[model samples]
Target: MYALVDCNHFFVSCERLFRPDLRNHPVCVLSNNDGCVVSLSHEAKILGIKRGVPLFQIADIVKKNNIAIFSSNYLLYSGISERVMKIITDTAKNVDVYSIDEAFIDLRNYEKKELVPLMRLLAEKIKKWVGIPVSIGVAPTKTLAKVAAHYAKKYKGYKQVCCIDDEQKRVKALSTFDIADVWGIGRQFSKKLTSFGVNTAYDFTQKKEFWVQKHFTIMGVRAWKELQGIPTINTTEINRKQSICTSRSFGATVTDIESLKESIAHFTAMSAQKLRKQNSIANIISVFILTDRFSKQEEHYYHTRSMALPVGTNDTAELILYAHQLLTELYKRGKAYKKSGVILSGIVPNSSVQQNMFDNLKNREKRSLLNKVVDNINSKSGLNSVKYAAQISTDKKWTTKTSFKSPDYLTNINELFEVH
Candidate 1:
């Protein structure tokens, strides 16, 4: 059996962990620059404040309903995620961290009768220890465990844990679960399957395997088999990401090329950090810029350009120089760019990279060591504690708007909770 343990309304829940008064009120966590609603409390959802709705569009509802709002405080979220993952690692023998708020646990060795109680205990322990509510769904496969997790979160009576350890329970759950929401089923497949009268996960599983293969190919067939309690998906850590891209919508429309360069440098530095984390080097670096799609006043511009490196690198300095070169070519005067990003691709393991005997890769060993030193310092201190000179210097010029962000209570010593 595999159990999918996921935090309930994670961002909002994280906010509520500090402000208990907001526990019963309508609340939401906005994306960068407070652009749109990315997460909300159940009360806000009940009030029909849809996810991804612009904060501006819901101002009336927020004002009338006394809704609490927050900016995306990634520092806080990341700290809390680390704590949650630690608790899970200590609880389960084998675990795959699925996302910031979810993990897949291998519960195969446990006796069938103990699955429910053990999972329930794990949920309670997380709530008590981490002060974050989680729902657990145990099943024979990762896909069904995902479905069970949905039920655990949706229904109150499940006591925050649900398990489909038997065939009957599997049928009952799959029958009511929407096909579109099933694991591995994307929006396109969901629409096509619905058109074929496959409205539920059980419906999809009922189709002939060859028929599913004909329409949606082998991947869809695997999803069908997974829904039927057969484990086709392997839960393993991804060794390397195909591409590393770091981009964010600006807090405000930026008109200056210098400020846009700062954003590019910062995002490139971030991509480099990720590349190092994955123990990989990138052979290609791409830079792109965008103007607000909805703005009628500004002419639209969206373009991306890429260049292959003579030698792949994960060094922040090397990546930033290329990023600046790309931005210089791509930036246009009088264009109020709303977003910019850096993408690094053609990645290979840093250890496997072959040194060019011909090309004088200036102090390659020194650059790699310097990156390690900076990463360690930043990790021990705060995010980007040691950063490239090209990145933004002043906190005031920070690209993303976090006007309503909560304190970094967990990560910062000064912000730690105090009692009177």
Candidate 2:
């Protein structure tokens, strides 16, 4: 059997993790730049406040209703996610982290009598220890496990546990759920299914495999099989990332080439550290810059440029040089730039490559060793221990807005909040 565990109102839950007083109150976490609501608590949802509603539009409503708002604190959220997943992994024989707030675990080894209680215990432990409430669903397949999780969350006093081990319960759950609620059914497919009088999970499951495959795509076929209690997907262990990129919007629009170069260099250094963390090297580098469309100015621009390396490298200096070259080509002098980013692509595992044959530099080995030493020092001491000339400015105009942001709580000393 597979068990799917999903956290309830994840971002809101993360906020509440540190401030339990926020429970039973309307709370939301805003998106980057505090532009819109990205996550909302159940209380906020009950107030008819929908996700993605712009913050400015809902500011009056939020203030009048005494709603609590927080800026996105990814450092805290990611740290909490890692802790919660570790708890689930310790309990389950096998666990696959489906997302930041959801995971799938294999529970076939446990007896039916032992499964639900253990799942309930696990959920309670996570809530007690990690300050996140979780809903769990267990079934013969992953899709049904997802369905079970939805039901587990819909009604209270299920103790956050829903199990579909028996045929009767499975049939009843399928019959009550809408066709669109099924795991992989998109709106268009759901509409087509409704036309065929298949408006629920039961209706979709009742169709033959051949019919599902003929009318729908492979995804549909997989969902169909999963609904019929067949395991259509297998769990794979999560591996380290191949590439990482960090990009952000400017605090104010910038039009100068020097300021743009500074932003690109900072982002490039961050991306290089990320690459070094994965013990990988990039074969290509890309830089992108764009202007704000909302600026009332008629001249809006977006451009990206990428260059391939003569050989794979993870050297921050070399990466920044190439990034600056790309930025120079892409940046126009008079146009206002709102955002910029650097990406290191074509990443390969450290063990995948052989020494280059074409390069004739006698000090190539020395350069590689020096790069590794620089990475180690920067990683221990904070980012940019070794700075680039372009990023020498003490004040950065392109920083993100995080006025209402909570304490990092897990990372950063200066940003930590304490209640005296």
Question: Whose TM-score is greatest here?
Answer: 1
The stretch of ten residues in a row with the least summed lDDT in candidate 2 is 234-243
257-376, model 1: which lDDT tens digit per residue? 888889999999989998998799999999999999999997789999999988888989988999999999998989888889999999888886766777556798898899999988
Best by lDDT: 1
Every candidate's lDDT: 0.89, 0.85
| C-alpha lDDT (0 to 100) for residue 276 of candidate 1 | 95
lDDT agreement of model 1 with the native: 0.89
TM-score of each: 0.93, 0.83
